[model samples]
Target: MYANTPRTTATRHRDRMSYDRDLVHSVLDEAWVCHLSFVVDGEPRVLPTLHVRIGDVLYVHGSTGSRPLRSAQPDGIKVSVAVTLLDGLVLARSQFHHSANYRSVVAHGTATVVTDPAEKSAVLTAIAEKIAVGRAADTRPPTPKELAQTSVLALPLVEVAAKMRTGGVSDDPEDYALPHWAGVLPLRVVAGDPEPDKGVEGVPDYLRAVIGVTG
Candidate 1:
């Protein structure tokens, strides 16, 4: 267990919650997007964007002028970032027992805009690799102008929590006799055939490996 501060503790369904760093990183790594929440002008704002976890730090990027990106600073600007992956839908005998099988991680920390040139460039590369393993190497590197136009925020994985629920529906004991269907409708993210670019050549082995496994 680690980073289990009061801010990361759950008030309900505590049994489903965890303070484990491994669990947090697993959920974060599998997620494609994260919802970053922060206060802007006295209003709570949540923005869905690309995020990557390199070691214990989470990096999110955006247009330099965007409110969330611009407002982030080294000063204490409290923020929370969360990633959720739904595994299945639980269909219960009764409506009240409905639920979802999901894995989620919520992290609370201060948001700071990354300024160091080397670190900033590395983070951008990491973000690209997160999207696709071989993508960063396949594409041309960003220019100085491109880097200047973007802003990246680094959120430390200090106070974090992970929650998950799996398995079948839980209904009242008496409702078990009901003639309604009760089972889990499993879900997954699968990949289809690769869409090649104009006049592209052979499919990269790394990408082919991904599609082969997912397919």
Candidate 2:
């Protein structure tokens, strides 16, 4: 649990909410893209990328020719990864009271390359499946040359914090009488109809099971 882990300067308090590890992992699992931040050449860089969570390990991929991937080789990689989901827009009578309702997770950890071929292949499959469940089995596996041209890194979720704000708008007591409505406009992510690519003979049962639908 996050409460069991010591809160340092980096992992200290979140003003709005208290979170356990389960809440944090749940938020991460629901999100597809994460922003990865690290220091390179004494300058900070943040990259938005797709990632997959397998247990406590988070996997990120890049081309073998990437500069940041090359820089991660010699020195240990210190990174901060974050994901945020906006749930609603909070409208209040006072401008100061305006805010957003969101759930977010921040994790600080060290990243290292996955060197084993078998493990690398499995991680790649997990990544593909995450994009669209069961897509990995339908597509051709990566060739030897393609495997050699890709880079994968694993970052353990050692220190993490989740913060969230929900419910209706909060307005100042004095401003509540002002001529403005206050409430939350909810939002959500819904999947659209699945479209097959050209030359596809038919969708398989494994894919149907993965998507929880049948045509």
Candidate 3:
């Protein structure tokens, strides 16, 4: 078992906290979006973007003209990223006891621009394939101009923590007999039907497999 990495003065911590690298990676791999928080001009800004995980590294991309991409210069970029997945809603007998059962990972690290064309291409492929498994195989590779206009940043999974809350609501002992209904309202991400582009001729097998639909 991996030991939980301790939270420092700057780290956020509460009851039932975890910081194991494996646990953090597991939560990150399951989610497609991440809130990347960073300091810009002495103010904190959070950017929500799609992300992909490769081993211990987290990759986030944007156009070269994007603010976040421009701000991440060679001097390095310090950032805190959060990925959360809500599993269910806990309904307690008392209104004050309501809470959400979730799995979340918060990571802090410095990001470096991926400049090498070969490596950048590979990372881009990983990003596409992650969004739709096997998509990279059918999609055309980025053109030279496209690659030059895009910016990819790699953030090593350094200091990180994963916190999770599960099970039913915790109500006061006396509230159990209050005659109020209590249970968990589950949440999930269900795949929707895949819609092809207006000019596209046929749906690709990978897209079909991604949405579990037959065209």
Best by lDDT: 1
- Candidate 1 lDDT at 182 equals 98
Report the candidate with higher TM-score, 2 versus 3. 3
Give the C-alpha miss distance for residue 20 in model 1, angstroms.
1.1
Model 3, 2-89: lDDT tens digits are 3444541235336657767777888888888888888877988788887788888888764534586666788678888889998899
Measured with C-alpha atoms, the lDDT of residue 183 in candidate 1 is 96
For candidate 3, report its TM-score: 0.87
Question: Against the correct fold, how does model 2 do in TM-score?
Answer: 0.82
Off by over 4 Å in 1: 212-215
Candidates' TM-scores?
Answer: 0.91, 0.82, 0.87
- Candidate 2's residue-wise lDDT over 55-133, tens digit each? 8887776443458765587444888888888888998888888888888887777888777778788888887786567
> Model 1 TM-score?
0.91
| Model 2: lowest-lDDT 10 consecutive positions | 4-13
Off by over 4 Å in 3: 1-15, 64-68, 212-215
Please give, for residues 72-182, the per-residue lDDT of candidate 1 as tens digits: 566846788989999999999999989999999999888787777777778888877866788789878877777776677888888888999998989999999999999
lDDT of each: 0.81, 0.74, 0.78
Clashing pairs in 2: none
Q: RMSD of each candidate?
A: 2.0, 3.7, 3.3
- Residue 47 in candidate 1 has what lDDT? 82
